[model samples]
Target: MAEKEKQEDYRVEIGGDDSKRSYTPAPAPSVSNSPTMAILSYCGASILMTLTNKYVLSGYDFNLNFMLLAIQNIICVVAIQGAKSMGSISYRDFKMDEARKWFPISLLLISMIYTGSKAIQYLSVPVYTIFKNLTIILIAYGEVLWFGGSVSRLTLFSFGLMVLSSVVAAWADINAAISSYGHDASETATALSTLNAGYIWMLVNCLSSAAYVLGMRKRIKLTNFKDFDTMFYNNLLSIPVILLCSLFLEDWSSANIDRNFPSAQRNNLIIAIIFSGLSSVFISYTSAWCVRVASSTTYSMVGALNKLPIALSGLIFFDAPVTFPSVSAIAIGFVSGLVYAMAKVKQQKVATTSLPVSSASSASMRDGLKN
Candidate 1:
């Protein structure tokens, strides 16, 4: 899977435009547009996006996460509209039927982004990033339950490691907090409570994200929307929903621009949101380009490999505490992601080989002879 949250954020390059058609992997691009270059662009943009959002939510104390997301979505919608006007992209007009069909899945997406933001607000970047690994497992199991796919032994082993690492990481985080802040009973209690809340929200984030991914798999088929179309509809439809959520769920008095604008960091918050929006645009383009230039297999590997750099950057950039178990847990999670990536490659290869192309052709020829 791609490292990014939104599935429709990428433009998948395919041979034709049959909405319900199956996909065949395209050949890799040439040296000038190499997989390495694509992967680097994608990884860089994604890392920047993640760090920027974390800074906005945590460092800038712009805790109105839903509103921030709404702003981002608005930016995306404008960009898409402009691109359409400029002939840079093509998309279908919005339809009420499709909008109605997409409403429930959009709710799942909103939940995913909201809980993910809350998780980042409460947890360190490294912890939050590592916990995101659980999404892979959640989506995998969700496929097994909802799509009739069976889990293999390797997948089982990898997911088991991820689960174990999550437990160890949580324990390490709690202990490290106690060691650092144990002198003040009240502070220690607050730290413990925050950690607990962060983990709970992280779990919710994983489940909701998993649900969104799985639901989109079916929803996309029904809608027959390609990448740009999907992005347009998903973001456009989400604006109103996100606004309602921010209004009801958020404390607008504190998050209001009139109140926070007087603060010294107002300029900083503006800069952060601008950068966040630009980086999001960068990510959408680079990630899709990566998938187009590289194979999906290489894209998956890049996503797996990028986790280490993101984990390290979190610890270096932020003041997240370092501990043996926490470090070890990240390492284990990294390896598990690699395992999952390898498993995916093997499965794709198997699926390709298992296609009965020759038999289908032969049957067609026999029918032609009869005709």
Candidate 2:
């Protein structure tokens, strides 16, 4: 405990106080605050979100991603407030200053969701999931830039594998795009167009996601905000931004109200929407909870490990083609992600080990000077 305090003091001195932030590491996981439950909730919510979006966008032709996200944000705000009212969780009262500090991160969050939904609308879930690995690469680079850390040789090697795997997956997508070559010229043209647009949106989503995660890290550290506080601020503040974007960007005239959202189909749509919103809530809460209980590296590893299952589920549920190239690309992506996760875990362990030694050395020097 003394050593831990010394290390904490050393870290604060080196890292500088984050605006006189009242820093508090979240409590360790117990039966009441279970890591396993958090992980399960995160995984389930993520999978449901992916599957639900695919069904709505691809199956029902409901292409208003911005509008959908706005609705989801609204739902999040209402549900969180309801929970607070019931005393399920506690958060500090919202202040204008804190909202202003949180707005930039909210913008990044909006971009990430908007672009990701657009990509999912165009790309099959499997292809989209594989390509989404690119976000890991971007986040790794962001950490290096923001935190002033050096990447290890092994970590660099893992990054190389990830890059190679992403390239191969992209190649497979291109090949799939043109595979309808002889069947229907018009269909081939459509597939090619969607593939092109999907790749662009996917890349945009990766960049935005990386930025959001990094910004969220800064906000949490600097403001000393807890998970529920972060969720409340992000969703509540994003509602208006999302609404404005929807008004300009979405084609309200093109929305087939009767066909896409008929009264008879309202049940399915309602279920999908409600579940989608709730799942998003689950994701946000669980992700933050998991990171608090476990380490950030563990949170990252859970995400990396889930990719393969998600990819496989997509294949099983969707009508996508299964060829040697596609299979190989998926395998490569899964393997590369695993390697990246391992490299990251090792890197974090090294950092942890070095912290105690550095703190001890500093303590020794202080003692010697006093003597």
Candidate 3:
């Protein structure tokens, strides 16, 4: 998930029919076209978080996905409170009104993470990484309709390539998996399933994740939430709902507990859960920061773009098939990301740079009219 926070001080100028507002950057010395550092921060934290999640879920011994989420939320809340006490970061104490407002977004986040865990349990990491790019289209158009954002033609072309890459990756993954059952016609027929359970969960995850990001982006601006506030509220408000689900949906017997946290791997599991929680603070902050400083589409694009390394790493570490078609698909994604980034930079530069000239002209005309 992502949110927009612009790096430069900018204002919306209302003009034209029906009071349509335009999002143009104000004339400022530090009118950066993009939040390069925030993008980097998100990429780093997001990748670390994803890899660790995959590691913990890879074995599927942990049956309770929501329980795991609850643990992480608990740790993150504790860490944030500790940091607040230490004066490292500060946010408004939990207000009922604000929590009421933020609760829907938290639910969306829970749906996204839970569905993602379900999907990732069955899908290869590389396929999951590539398919995530599909959310960019939804976000770009969502921004256009709801946030007064626009997508350039170059960006559209890049989107097409991204879609193609996902198709290729999915096809290659299925083919490689099916090849393992060669020389058996019955098995081949049975294994020809494309829309499996994992893919269904992945689709749900994509929709939920997109909704969460878009909703959070709009809500944060409306509420004037700082990054820390978003981080705190999302993690904090989610615990009760998650625990409630865990209560109903998960096993709590001592035998199940031992199975979930076996004695030998218990140390590793504890550390991973703690690390995931610690990193959530960073990931949440960076995600909100990126969306605020950048457009929602740009935030989504940059996150997917940065996944070039993630796709490759998933392939390397997860031992997914290293086929020619899969490699080419990754290459296509990389090139499209470059094209999209360049186009966004050019668009922002023109929009921001032209504002000063237009503002100056308006000012001069007003002075002449006064005289």
Q: Across residues 113-221, which tens digit of lDDT does each residue of candidate 2 receive?
A: 8998999888878788888877766766676687655666776776676677667777777787687574888888887888889999998998887777767776667
Local error of candidate 1 at residue 351 (angstroms): 1.7
TM-score of each: 0.83, 0.83, 0.78
Kindly provide the TM-score of model 2 when superposed on the true structure, using C-alpha atoms.
Answer: 0.83
Q: Which of the predicted structures, 2 or 3, would earn the higher lDDT when compared with the native?
A: 2
For model 1, residues 1-371, the per-residue Cα lDDT tens digits are: 56343444443665657654433445566764787787788788878988888888887545578888998888888887898899987889888998899888778778887898889888887788788878877776676787666567876887887787788778889998999899999999999999999999999999888778778777777887666666777778889989997899877784465554547777888888888877766777676677667665566656655777787888888888888988987898788878866776676566569963322111111111110
TM-score, model 3 to reference: 0.78
Worst 10 residues of 2 by lDDT: 362-371
Off by over 4 Å in 3: 1-41, 183-195, 285-302, 354-371
Error of 2 at 291 (Å): 2.4
Q: What lDDT is obtained when candidate 1 is compared to the true structure?
A: 0.74
Q: Candidate 2 lDDT (Cα, whole model)?
A: 0.74
Model 2 lDDT, residue 36, Cα: 83
RMSD of each: 12.2, 11.8, 12.8
